[model samples]
Every structure is written in C-alpha cells, then in structure tokens.
Target chain A: MNIDPVKALEGKVERLGKDLKALDSRLENAQTDAAHEQLGLSNQLKDTTRKLGRTNDRVTELAESVHRLERLLVALNRKVRAGETRKADFGNWPEIEKKELAKIFQGQEAYSRKTFTPQEAKDTRKAIAEYDRRAHEAIEAAESLTHLPANAESLWRKHYKQWHAITDKHRPEVPDDDTHAKDTAAKSAGNEAIKRTRQQIRARIEDAVANDLLFPAWFENAMGPAAPPGRADDWLYTATDVVLYRLLHDVTSPADALGPAPAEDGHRKTLYDRLVSECAEYRRP
Target chain B: MAADPFARLADRQQSLRTALRALQAAGPGSPDFPALLTTTNDEVEAVMQARRDVEAARLTTPNRAIAAGTTAAALIVAVGWFDAWSLLSLLVAVATAASVLVDPAGRRLWEPRARTTVITAALAATLLTPLLHGWATLITAAGIAWWAWRTQR
Candidate 1:
C-alpha cells in the first residue's frame, strides 16, 4: 500500500474536518464550554495580534517617550558631566512644586477632551472592528468544528498555504543588480528622519524634565501644559504630570478614570521608576 | 496671493503624500512590523470580552426570568383557566426552568475556566438543583441583585 505524503496530508485534513464536526455536537451540550473555549482562544489570538499592534504602537509612541526620557537623561548626564547642572535642577521642575503642577491639571484635562483626528478615532474603531470580526470567527469556528485551527498543524499548514501565499505573488520583483548598498543608505536615511521626529518630541521633555525650560505654546501643544504667567517651574511640572498622566490613564487604564481609587487612586508611577522609589523609601538593612 | 497660496498648497500636498506613504509602509500585514498588531488584537479581544460579558449577563437574567414567568403563567392557568397544566406545556416549562438554571450554572459553575465566585454560585445552584425549577428563580434573583449592587456601587 502506497502512502503518499499529499494523500497523508489530505487524510489528516479529512480527519480534522470529521473531528471538528464531532466536536460540534458534544461541544453543543457542553455548549457554553465550547463557545467560551473558542471565544477565549480567538480573543487571545485577536488580542495577541492587537496587542502585537498596540505593542508596536505603544513602543513607537513610547519610543518617542523613550527618546524623550533618553534626551532628558542625556542632557542631565551632559549637564552633570559638565558640572553645569545638578540633581537639584531636576527637583526644580515646576511639577515638583504641588501648586505648579496642579495649575496645569485644568489644561491637561482640557487636552484630554480634545477630539482625536478622524484618523485616530478611525483607528480605534478599526481596532474594535478587527477584534470583533476575528473574535466572532474564532468563537463560531470553535462551535462549528472542534479541530482547533490554532493547534491543528495540518489544517494550519493548509491555511497558511492558502492565505500565506500572497507574499511571493505581490512582492515587488527585485532588480537583478544588487541594491543592498542603496537600500542600506535609504534605511539609514529613514532612520535618521525617524530619529529627528523622535528628538523633537524628546527635546521638550528634556527641557521640562532636566533643564526646566518651558515654551508655553509648544509645551501646551505637544506635551499639554501651559506656563503660569510668570513661573517656568509650573509649566515644567505640568508637562511631566501630563505625560505621565496620559500614560497611566488614557493609554493604559480606564478603571483609573472611573472613580476615586483612594489608595493608589489614579496616581501611579512607572514600574521601573516605582521600583527605584520604593528602594529609596525602604529602611536600610 | 494665488501663487503664494498655490505654493503653500503644493507643499502641503507633498507633505500629506509623504505621510500617507509612510503609513502605507507601516500598515497592517506589513512585513517585519512591530508587535502593535498583537496589542491591538488584545485590546480588541478585551472589548470582545466586554461584549461577551454583556451577553452572558443578559443570558443569566432573561433565562431565569423566563422560568419565573413560565412558572407564574402555569400557576395562573392552573388556577384561572385550565384544569391542570398540560404535560407538554409542563415539559417545556421544566426545560425552560432547567435552561435558566443551567445557563449561568454552566458558565459560572460548570465551565472549566469559571471564576471562583461563579463556581461557588454554581455549586450552590447545584446543591439546590433537586428543587431547581423553583430554586432557579431565587438563585437568578440573587445573582441579579448582587450584580446590580456591585454595579451601582
């Protein structure tokens, strides 16, 4: 008896289809079991994909954040190295003075209410729609068939074959002559452009975080804080608060927005920095 | 003014085109893309979970209400109109009753992934299952009341 690989693959596929069907009925009586099983899986996959996207977005966004902090770190490092600035300079941020940071809460809250571009709003809607579509497909698939698409290698192979074949087909044909140097140069150029965009955002943070500089109009637009009529310190602290506040509330947690948390309340620090703070607050062994 | 306006317009168009091309480079299914897709996927799923929570919440209430309504209707018919509730109607009523109890019971109790409280509630429902038809009504009321209190607070 000849067992062809293709036939074997087909056999596996047929078996999967059959098993998936059987899983359907048994799963029905244990219906919620089956339903949620798919729901969780699909949601997980969808989430993983979305998370992957958001991670990319947040990373990119926070790449801006990182660059901002890095520039602050760099400038602070440079200042201390030059003996031109001290740790006291960081403490001098207007945000450090409670009254100064508090002054900008009004502006930051106003910024929060500001409408996102049609694109940003559209993206949020798109994320939601993509999630719903994939989630429904996952739950429905789980209910209809048992051979999990996620785990079924043979079926997945087939799925990959059918859906994953687009790359070669759509890929722009490379010119015969090598463009590696050109491509590398172009990428380097693009990287520099990205770096500049990043640094623009970061320069402000460095200004606020390290140098205690405040340009009210630019500060308000990018970092969301207006300078008090006379004090630069208020503007600086306000910027820090706005950035961190946006990270904690709008970007991460909605629960923080709901009611007074009272304990930690809406106040949270970066995990990395929080660890540092905790260490500072601890009694020495 | 027209030349200045046209130059500004041209520059704006060039900038807008540059931004769009950048986005196309970054769009979904873009090769070697960052993992933001996965985060978006998760947030999407969380949203989906929120939706499921709503549906699950709906099922828990309406289903038990269905049992309560049927039982009330049966009693009314038995007392007001019919000599006795027909066996067919009785079976449907019992099935509905069982369904009401079973829905949340399955979700909260029977589900392998059920939360501890839901599992506890399910276990409580199970212990009361022998008197399920009537007990289902009480349990549902309690669950709903608990939900309302928690939500309202």
Candidate 2:
C-alpha cells in the first residue's frame, strides 16, 4: 500500500477529471434543450398575440354593425310615432273646431237679436271679434296638424263670411226707425241663405252618391235605408238635413244643435231630439 | 193592422190644442182651468211619445232594396272600370267604395290625403297605359299601379 500511493493519487485525480468532463457535457445538453424550449415558447407567444389582434378586430366590426342597426331602429320608431300623432290630431280636430264655431255662432246670434241694448251690441261685436280670432287660431292649429278636407274648410269660411256680412250690415246703435226693420230683413235673409246652403249641401251629397263619387255612410245609418221609388217620405229629407248639419258641425248634443234656449216649437224640438239620438246611435260601438 | 202612430199623434195634438183653448177661455182663476191644463199637458206628452215611437220605428226599418241597389251600382261601376282600365284601377275604385261601405262614417280611413294620393296615382297609371306602348312603359305603369295599391293598403 505504501509503494502504490502516488499511482493511486494520480489514478483518483484522472477519475475526478473524467467525472468533471461528464458533468460539463450534461450542463451543455441542458442549455441546448432550454434554448429549444425558449424558441418554442416565443413562437407560441407570437401566435397568441396574432389571435388576440384578430379577436379585437372582429369585436370592433360587430360593434359598428350594432351601432348602425340601432340608428335604423330609431328612425323607424320616429316615423311610426309621427304617423300616430298626426292621426290623433286629425281625429280631435272636429270637436275642437265645433266648440270654436259654437262660440262664434252664439256671439253672432246675440248681436243679431233686436233685444240687445247699445252697450250690449258693442260688447257683442267685441265678443264676436274675439270669437273670430279664436276660431282662426283653432283652424290654423288644425291646418298645421294635417291637411283637412277642402270642403270642410270652405264651408266654414263661407259660413263665417255670411255671418260677418250680416253682422256688418246691421248696426243696432244707429237710431234709425228702419234699423229694426233692416235687422229683421237681414236676419231673415241670413236664415234663408243658411237654409239654401244646407239644401245645397244635401243636394251635393245626393249627387255624389248618384255619381258614385262618395257614399254617405253616416247619413244612411242615421236615416233608415233609402225609401222605395214611390214611397219616399217627407220626414226622410228633414231627418237627412238635420243629421248632415250635426255631422258637418260635429254636434253630438241636442243643446249644441238647438242652442241653450229651450225650443218653443214642437217640430224643432222633435228634430233636435232625433238628431241627438241619431248621433248617439251612430257613435255607439 | 197596426194603428197609425202619425194619426194617433195628430189626434193627440188636436186634443191638446182644444184643451189649451178651453183652458184659455176658462181663465186661470177658474177652478176647471188646472184640470184642463193638466189634461192638455198630458195630451202634449202623449203626442210627443207617439211621434218619438213613429220616428224610432222609421229609423230602424231601413229599405233593404236601396242599400242593395247602391252596393250593386258600386260593384257595377267598379267592374266597368276594370273592363275599361287595368286591374289596378279597378282595385283602387273598388277599394275606395269598399272603404265607404266598411266604415260609412270614414272613421277608420284616417288619412284622406293618402287616399286621394293613391286614387290619383292609380287613375294616372291607368290613363297612361293606353297612351304608352313598349316593355319599359308597361313595366313603369305596372310599378306605379303596384305602388298605389301597396301604399293605399
């Protein structure tokens, strides 16, 4: 053992060197494997970034389409709402106009009467002017809402013109002996004109039906069906006129058609009653 | 046979007038005047009720012949227009008539202006059909007619 110490030491050193060489080779192999794994991870990271970018682009495109769809829906909703509003306005116009005309008529009637004092006459004229202004406003409001039937507006204008003419022609303040006579004549003439106008309207309705231009559904409903060829009743014509007046004026109540003053005439009272009943019947569901 | 409501009403009115005259002649101071006045008022009321009954009866009983005739006439006119013009024209005419028939009060047809527009357009297309000839013209006419019909409905 004493003789082999140097050789043994040398052999141990050589074995230690060989072991160090093997550990160094293993470290190199591990670094190479780590480098290959790092490259693969880097490629995966790039692929993930690319997919995220595409996802972001697709999300942006979807958002833009949704925005466009929202705008279209908003526009369509607005159009439908506008149409409904217009229809509602048109439906409400007749009653509003009727109220305004009633006020005007009351004023006209007050001024037309012989019982009014000079001061009362003046007050009535002022009131009539105010009523006229209000009627104009109502008409303007209706016109702004939607286009009304031409005949409806024209008939109103014609009635107003006649009423204005009658009011202007008779000044009760004038201390003339014939002032009462003139007023009476003017009043009678106005009544006659109104009667003629009503007849004309009725004739127009008949003509429109005859020519197949228009059908008077309301009229037919109010007045029983048309009479037989030779069995035509007189009451039918009167009833037709009354119904037409109510329809044209949108008069639903007897007071509106016959005025607040009680009718002393039986025939007039009957007519008004019939009108009220017919209008009610027609309006029933 | 049913009693004539009109004749009954007239008789009641005559009786009321006679009682009124008698009451006037007797004067308000007379003891019988109150009874006469009451009787007269009763007669007036009776007459009014009779008149109302007659009117109610008349209003309910419509002449079926006239209604049928009107509808027939309208159909005939529509059919005649169809023969003379295009189907669109006939459609417009019939639709207009049907609207009146369906809603006699014109309550359902809220847009009179739209109705007028459709009717005018349909008429124009029908009228222009005879004046124009060619595939393009026919297509245009057809388009206009279809547009009118679609818009109206």
TM-score of each: 0.20, 0.21
RMSD after CA superposition, every candidate: 42.3, 36.3
Kindly give the stretch of ten consecutive residues in candidate 1 chain A with the minimal lDDT sum.
A142-151
* Model 1 accuracy (lDDT, Cα): 0.41
Specify the highest-TM-score model's number: 2
| Poorest 10 consecutive residues by lDDT, candidate 2 chain A | A85-94
Q: Report the Cα lDDT for residue B71, model 2.
A: 44
Deviation from native of the Cα of residue A120 in model 1, angstroms:
36
Backbone clashes counted, model 2: 1
Q: Runs in model 1 with CA error above 4 Å? A: A1-285, B1-25, B55-59, B78-86, B102-153
lDDT by residue for model 1 over B1-153, one digit each (tens)?
Answer: 123433333343344334333433555345532243343333333322333343354345644555555555555543444322233343444444554555542332112112223333433443343345344445534544454443342
Q: For model 1, how big is the iRMS in angstroms? A: 17.0
Residue B86 error, candidate 2, Å: 99
lDDT of 1 by residue, A1-285 (tens): 327988888888999999999998886779778787998999889979987998888778877777556645654455556554322221123323343333334333333333445456566666656644543343333222222222233442342233222222222222322243444454455445434433443455665445534333323343222232354454444444434444333333322211222244222433324433332222111
lDDT of 2 by residue, B1-153 (tens): 238865665565566556555655664435564465456446544544554444433422232222233345435544554444444444444454344334332211123333333334433443444343122234434544654453454
| Candidate 2 docking quality: incorrect, acceptable, medium or high | incorrect
- Model 2 Cα displacement at A138 (Å)? 51
